[model samples]
Target chain A: MNKCHITNEIRKFRFLQSEMTQQELAEKVGVTRQTIVAIENEKYSPTLELAFKIARIFNASLEDVFTYNA
Target chain B: MYRKEKMILASLLATIAVFAVYSLYVYQHYVVPKPEIIHDFSFWGKSFLFLALVMVAAQIIVHIVFAIINKIVTKKDIPVISDEMDKIIELKSLRVSHLIFAGGTFLAIGSQAFGIQQWIMFAKLFSSGFIVTILSDITRISLYRKGL
Candidate 1:
């Protein structure tokens, strides 16, 4: 939580995917939509399972969705 | 299940449980068809039977509702609970219950050591114990939800 990290591009991916609702993605990925929002805002970090889920949904590598600042 | 949906379902089940207990009380007291064995039954023993029934009914209802909802909502079966974050929060909540259990037992002993005249009766002791565990669990859950 302390180390710097760039937030997820989930919102952008979500928008690109014909405006997928948070709830829809949450259902697909098996997490609460609130968790999706938290990850987007960088307020919370997703578990490895969820991070992989997001990457899968976006059809991108983990690096595409997330990055470390330092 | 979605967390919010789980919460709503839990709240509904809790409300139903209270109603079920009240219904049983009324039936056992004034509204029942007739007492099976009127004079021979111990009142406390009858109450204990009703309490057990309520507990069993509540458990059944919770499972039934969760199963039904999950079936209706999705083809994929999601656990009522999921994942490590949830497990951690649940474990923390359970810890509060243990703390309250220990504290209440200690307090009861302390009162006896002070030479209090009356014993903590079974009903009072049971109610106190129940309240401590449940209150602690609920408060702890709320704290965890709020990021404590």
Candidate 2:
């Protein structure tokens, strides 16, 4: 089976958005900071709802925040 | 380490400690003094029941103590709410533990089928339960560390 890898530009967007900290973003998205770290490191894939929430936080579309690699 | 990971580690340590202490107490007080008690079904039943109750109480106390120590050392409140990732990790670890426990059960039953002593069968069951507990914690810790 082929593995699906999802990557994100959360760090870049976080930097663009007044240098927001992971903890701040986590609080805004209602997840723990460790979760944010995992997502940023590509160690985990967020659900669609969470992905949308994160993109919404950055005032961007889902595509702008995340990319899918198969 | 994340707070959840630390909690898992603490739980693992607590389990080992409790099992060690309980096993020693049981051995010195019961098994050594009256080896024939091994044949008593009621004795096995009571031991299992008491061990379970003690484990639950120990876990509760460990968590409380850990929370207090964590607050003092980190000066930050531990995350009480679990997020989506936490749920996924928990489910995955649970599945692994369940499979292991099932296998253990089969082995324990097989021991009885093979005409093993009744006490050996009970010991098998107890050992399997202990192994399952330890492996579950280990699975959780690994998932938290390496991610899903």
TM-score of each: 0.58, 0.97
Clash pairs (backbone) in predicted model 1: none
Q: Native-vs-model 1 lDDT?
A: 0.62
Full-model lDDT, candidate 2: 0.91
Please, what are the lDDT tens digits per residue for candidate 2 over residues B1-148? 8889999999999999999999999999999999999999999999999999999999999999999999999999888779999999889878988898888888888888788888888898899899989998998888777876
Where does model 1 exceed 4 Å of error? A1-7, A32-34, A37-44, A60-70, B1-53, B62-81, B117-124, B140-148
Q: What is the TM-score of chain A in candidate 1?
A: 0.86
Candidate lDDT (C-alpha), each: 0.62, 0.91
Tens digit per residue, CA lDDT, model 1, A6-68: 567888888999999987887788865655665676755677787888899889999888876
- What stretches of model 2 exceed 4 Å from their correct place? A1-4
Lowest lDDT 10-mer window, candidate 2 chain B?
B139-148
For model 1, the interface Cα RMSD in angstroms equals 4.5
Q: Give per-residue CA lDDT, model 2, range A4-69, as digits (tens).
A: 399899999999999999999999999999999989988889999999999999999999899998
